[model samples]
Target: GRPLRVHSTEDGPLRAYRVYHSSWLRAAVVAVTFSHLLLALIEPRAGDGESYYTSFGSRANEPPDAVRAGLGRDVLWAELVMLLLYAADNMLKVYAVGWGNFFSVAAYSASSMFKTEKWDVLRIALVFAFLVEVIVALSTDVAWRPLRFLRPLFIVSYFREVRRWVAVCVKMIPKVFEMFLFILVVIGLYAVLGNLLFFKSGFYADEELQNFDTIGHSLVSVFVLLSSENYPTIMNPAFFRPDHTGSVWYGLYFFSFLLIGLFCLSNLLVPILYQAFKHHRQRLALKNHVRERRALLAAFQELDQNRNGLVTLARFTDLVVRLRPDIKKGDEDAATIAR
Candidate 1:
């Protein structure tokens, strides 16, 4: 065999072959360009509401309609881009790799677009929408079997950029876990103090500590009070009892602590929980991903006969025999194999 020359130039044929031959790379370019165009067209019309769509609203009384309308527009544009990419990908596969391979490659390419920022919104949405049209078109049913093979190809799209993102997230996971544990500790402390000082045996027992029975009970009550809009009503009657000065002081202290622990602490935990949940889910996904990659690597290694890192049929048969010890050598020889 002639020596295979490597090129360093960006526009080299090898680079071009990798780019054009890769369904994912092509889909990503298309998906991102289309998403940006769609976002640019729709974002200005969203006005100040665009900011609200990306972040949780600070204002408690903000109308649902305003929020929903803003979110709906962004969602619509995202879906539009996804649909366009799906159609383009299908068409390209049909033209390049025949109808039989179209579903598989298109499914793979669509999965690959998840790594691109332009299509990331759609990708995240798809996680929640797996039972819906997008995944069904890509991965479910006999008609979509080819799509299953392409699923692994999507990982390639993430190789360069996602590694960096994963690295940052990996570094932050321990810190986030520590913060979450700290919040849990604070909640535990509050429960213990609230029970011992206020609920268990105190002067304000009848009023301030009416419903609470134990430390656990008081903690539940505190959680309820913090979450409720009727907290002010509950507090006013208990704290203002003219007969007990102790009740007044206890109420004031409880209310102050409740505000800090429930409102402030709970709100802070929201983002931490979000990040932790994301990290855990991604960890599970990464584990499964590694397993799949290992299987493919094993298959490739088996194909490399003569221990030369080059694939051939003889090595593949040896690997098959190694994998299936139950089959006799005669049966293995009789098995029809593809080149």
Candidate 2:
């Protein structure tokens, strides 16, 4: 259902969408989500993520009956019901967001909500959630079921920090790419050094040192070495063997690798994330500060209740009670029931 639009003046434009704005709706979303999460934590089904990836091809010929017997059927039905509700909720949001000029075909309908700038994240999320819902709903495979969890973006929207964190991370994308390029260059240089000092030195004549046999192998080996995965075993032959870089150069080579590969390039992420977070938080703070300038005025507009130009005290109190329901509490019973 369309929410009653609030405007300061009779002929003024509508303010914001309020279809999904009720506290009851918020509580329903939180309640349903936690129920599903609790069910998911305890219920183990046959077609989970690991089983799907590892056994899908092999089990392609297996009958549906063979996959699960009793309890899985119950879980599957519950999941389908939830997924349908999720899809329905997304459809309601589409209507809530977009304005339709039913009087004129010149104006777009519900789909036109995407054109507006303010609700871009919610718009993208609506489409993505619906798509995941449909895909999961049609398929019996439980692996795709995990995608249904993303339908809660609307719930998470109440916490603005998620959006702030996303904005900061989006700003860091270029900086991250720059760091990646530098790391690749360092890895490439070390790969060439491995090719020259080990493979070219005839270390590959022994099968034990075959990892350094080619430039590709040398590149991968350098990556493994930098990660410190089985480091001593992978590099000990090159270090101790007199035919290669030798014991004398071991400390200098590995130390330089650590200094360049692990320490220097990796540390850049810390400052970049910090800087992005700081800038985003400042932007949100300033935006909120500007919005607060119009706070009482906007509240008065909403409080007008009737389409009249000015608000009386009674209408003002009604709007406050409507907006903040906590003030409606009368006794311990009311408070407990509210909780």
Candidate 3:
């Protein structure tokens, strides 16, 4: 039995990839991003900011009055224009690549348009914020407008070094969290000890409100003392009584806590984080290097057409000319690299 099928006509993915990577399109996005940031800087603050519209009725049938005024009017118009431009840019990419490819939810790879662009999440958020702004415009509320301040994040994708730095920071999150938890535990223990030892002391009782009367207060006092803030004043009551005589061991407790918590444990976190950053960066560099070697190997294999594991100089030159038609065959400068 013969099977009959109908084929659907659609733009090819290769063509879509080409269009999305067009230089002019990228340049336009950069220009718009810069303009958006510039406008954000001068954008008026809330309560201090003015609105271009006013609402007179609570009914849905009543539309807001469009009486434009102040710097807000121009800023609002510019924002709307930028929104439209951003939307158009995104739409063009979507139209070329189809909706699924343009708004991918899968893991990142070279072929995924959304992941490669690195702005899908932020751009989608920006679009939603625009919609919210329009809905809230009638009531003259612009609380969500400050989200535009994140516009500079879009520019980070343009720089490879910046992206690498961001990736390193992201990778450090878990380790940083663990270290923070460890520090909190150490502080908690110190707080409990301080509460037990100092609760009945003259130091805690002299204050209008007892600082070390309970675990909670002791925790706050110890944390504050960690910063060495007026520590001598705090240590005085424990150091010397009204008769100028007290046990030296009272002062020793504060000194020991400062030594272990402030100088030792707190400073230990720095070298640990530095090591983590260094390791992640080295791993990233290795991954990139391997990828480059694999690509070069694949290119070499393609050049060795006869499968002899070696490419003739003539063959290499011909392949180069074939790959880039603009490079004329007889150009020695272009062919020299084939050697």
Candidate 4:
């Protein structure tokens, strides 16, 4: 037989969060987020990152102007409309939260501020997003089209970890940018040095000069060297050729660039990412723990025979013994478990 049912209060405190508290509403928000994400995924950027047109190619043989005829024509305006919807949704959430806390606010507004802070962050982010969208929408430059791709942020509202992942990326940007600057400086410095050393070694220098004569060319050469393409052509003259200086230092130059530019910079990214993922994992573990605790309590509530808080030991014993006949009443584990 099933365990007795009761309205015992031992289950837990009321789980009445104001925003997205309704299951149906939460599901709706998730569905909307997924739809927005799908729209974002299908909409391809115009060639060279232009914004006005995109493709939803169903076939490789589709015409070039396929996007201009279909979703691309209206996708831009549609995105703006979606942004408006998101803003309105956020606004409604704020209103609901405020009203839910109205009575408590009258009594102790300062202490009760926690209730609305989540919505406040949401509102601010949405407002900023709206402003940026409007600016890009009104702009006439091709560059602004790429900014439209940022619409995927629509998913953040539905997924907590996505939001935190973005936050961590934002926080790590400064350090990562600093590393980028360091590498840029290294490339520029090496480019100059290489051009000076190899720019006009001899008559053969002209033949050897694919990307080492000018500053811009040297920059490209250094970048290409990092990729290690046609590397033997660049180094052979400096070391093996008879008219060459025969100084093996060119090997050291390229080697050091590979060492500092590629190796060191890659190592720096690992820890920042590790810390972010570790923090999110810990958060997920805590979230799962609370959910499991609630489920266990809910199951216990189903077994509680009376409306009063605790389930008596007699009911627990009867329930467990019936559920598991192998565990006799006299077994110490069963007795302890029932107690």
Candidate 5:
């Protein structure tokens, strides 16, 4: 049997790893990425000051506006700079982790790969879009800019905390699907019932198809009613006939649907999501704790110079200084805490 091999930071170039993990480098990348997104928003909009005819007219003869179609000059340059930086960032990671380890599908366990490798591929697509826009601008009247709105997705990847939240949300996908199916089933049942009870009831005008005239129409109406919007419009017709002769019993059907669908079932989603988030957070914390303990044990074993199970205070302080050189060597408190 073959042993399961695992790759870690040690497999990569140490110098590149240090530079990749440096605080200042991450801050610079984040700042540039955010500026790229900000510039995209504040750039001029299409037809802001033009006449109605020109603004809303057929675009067939109108000259292509590269800024409106693809990316404005301001955003284009920013995006170019950011993509270069991101590309460099990926290069550094590849150097640190090695090519096979960096791009391997099995390496997705490293959470950083969730954004890094995927976004690298997305960046390649974006570069192709940039080239197409440039070619179109130089050769034809048509604008084929694909980088207009997608450049901002990379910005979220720079925030480590946000990345974790996104991972948690991804884990909640199954639960979300379950909730969606439950809602669909409930809506289907109510739609069939509504169609049976309200078909040809004359509460809806002959011209209006939005009423429960068919199963499909009833489904759409009930779905809308589940949001509690236009409740009087839907309920008033059912409670009082078109001729103004009716009974209060019609109100019970709507009241029950609202009680179950609007108030009860819809509200179930909040707690389900909350519980999923809470569980994810706890699991993450536990995983981090276990990893920390393993790392600490490994460090302690390495620091134990002798085969015996103890480390000197001096050695521990030296280890601390080696790991965090920013700590002053003369700080006795750091050594004391190390003891």
Candidate 6:
């Protein structure tokens, strides 16, 4: 017998060992790929048949059979694309873990399994799901839009820890209402007093002034006092002659109510307006911060190669090194490259 010769590259024993070991892996890859392709084919069947190719083909004059065939082809193509995407996604999951880790693998596997089950009850389930999602999303958006505009103010309030301050203000609302009621009561009191003293014929007959002999005349007297108008005409007997004596006490009482009601009540609105203005300013600042942060994030993401969330120091260094080569070649000027 000739001497047995062995080649270094040929591992007869190991090759036989690998045949058994690699078989399951190769089978899984092929199975996943095929399943993905099938899923893709099925997905396009769900399309509305308004794809670009379908639209293009419809423009031409053709027999019914040809047009129908073309439409079918488009549907099949879309389904195939979807299936490929599905298969690729599944294959990546399978590659990440061996079949022995079935429990862990099951998590990623559920999407395809759920989708398959969903298709069985798709008509009713999909319609309901879509409607529910749309309604919920729209409702949330409607609720959020106004609040989003007021976010800056809300944040400022939070930062200042002003809930207690707001509570205090809220507590004062009833007191403010009571004060308003008091002002109304004072005005009514004066209106009635003036009507009795000036408008009644019996009261006016004894007074020297004949001017204050009507309801209209008494109302004018009350208006002048409420406005803090202290003209001597208000006290003259010609103004309220026959009905009653014009006392200095009337002017003093009317002026007191005017000062309390008009001046003090109007000043109360200042704090409310100040709070609103503060919130507006805070909101503008927050919006500017968000815009700036978004721009910075977009710039960083543009340079991210792997699409992982973080921009690493290594990635930054690599980008700088790559730019240096371009600089050396004068492909980009320093000023332009800086941007």
- Highest lDDT model number: 5
Off by over 4 Å in 6: 1-244, 302-305, 308-339
- lDDT per residue (tens digit) for residues 1-339 in model 1: 111122222334334434444677666855554453354343322223233233223343464355654654555446555555544543442344333332334435523311123233333343234225334432321122122233222342324355445655677768577776766676567667666665544433555443355776666656656566545643554566566545555666677767886778778867876776677668868976875776667657746646787776555565556445555545645254423
Between candidates 3 and 4, the one scoring higher on TM-score is: 3
Each prediction's total of clashing residue pairs, residues at least 3 apart in sequence or on different chains, is: 2, 0, 0, 0, 1, 17
- lDDT by residue (tens digit), candidate 6, 235-306: 454335555555665566546656764577546545655665566557657976876676667658877768
Per-residue alpha-carbon lDDT of candidate 2 for residues 1-339, written as tens digits (9 for 90 to 100): 222433222222222234355577657756765665565553443354533233334454564343443344455467556555555554554454443432223333333312333333454465466556545634644444555455455445534566666667777777577767878998899888767666655545655533677888878877887777766766666667765556555567777887877777768867876776677778878977765655655656766768688876555455545545457634354444434
lDDT of 3 by residue, 1-339 (tens): 111111112435435545556688778888977887787565554432433332122232455434323455667777778778777766655655456644555514763323325555466666667756744652565433546556667566444567778888889988688888887887798788777778776565766433778887877777877777766656667776787756666667788888987898779889889999988988988988876776677678877878998888888888777545568789985578677
Q: Which candidate wins on TM-score? A: 5
Q: How much is 267 displaced in model 3, in angstroms?
A: 2.8
Q: Residue 27: error of model 6 in Å? A: 69
Task: Write one digit per residue (lDDT tens) for candidate 5, span 1-339.
Answer: 111122352534656767887899988877877776786464433343443223223474586464454434444455566667776886786677667875667666654432234655555566556546545433543333445577566764556566687789899888678898998999999888888788867786642656898888888888878988776777777775657666555677788899999788889988998898888889999998886776677667878969589988788787777556568667976686687
Off by over 4 Å in 3: 1-40, 47-69, 84-146, 149-152, 176-178, 197-217, 229-249, 302-308, 311-326
Q: What TM-score do all the candidates reach, one by one? A: 0.32, 0.61, 0.67, 0.50, 0.71, 0.28
* Colliding residue pairs in candidate 5: 12-96
> RMSD, each candidate, Å?
16.2, 8.0, 8.3, 10.6, 6.5, 24.4
Give candidate 5 misplaced runs (Cα > 4 Å): 1-15, 39-74, 104-142, 145-152, 206-209, 240-242, 245-249, 324-339
lDDT preference between candidates 1 and 6, better one: 1
lDDT for 268 in candidate 5 is 95
Question: What local lDDT score does residue 238 receive in model 5, on the 0 to 100 scale?
Answer: 71
- Tens-digit per-residue lDDT, 283-325, candidate 4: 7679778766766787678778586878888778877776465
For model 6, the run of ten residues with the poorest summed lDDT: 142-151
| Local distance difference test values of all predictions, in order | 0.49, 0.57, 0.65, 0.60, 0.67, 0.44
In candidate 4, where is summed lDDT lowest over 10 consecutive residues? 5-14
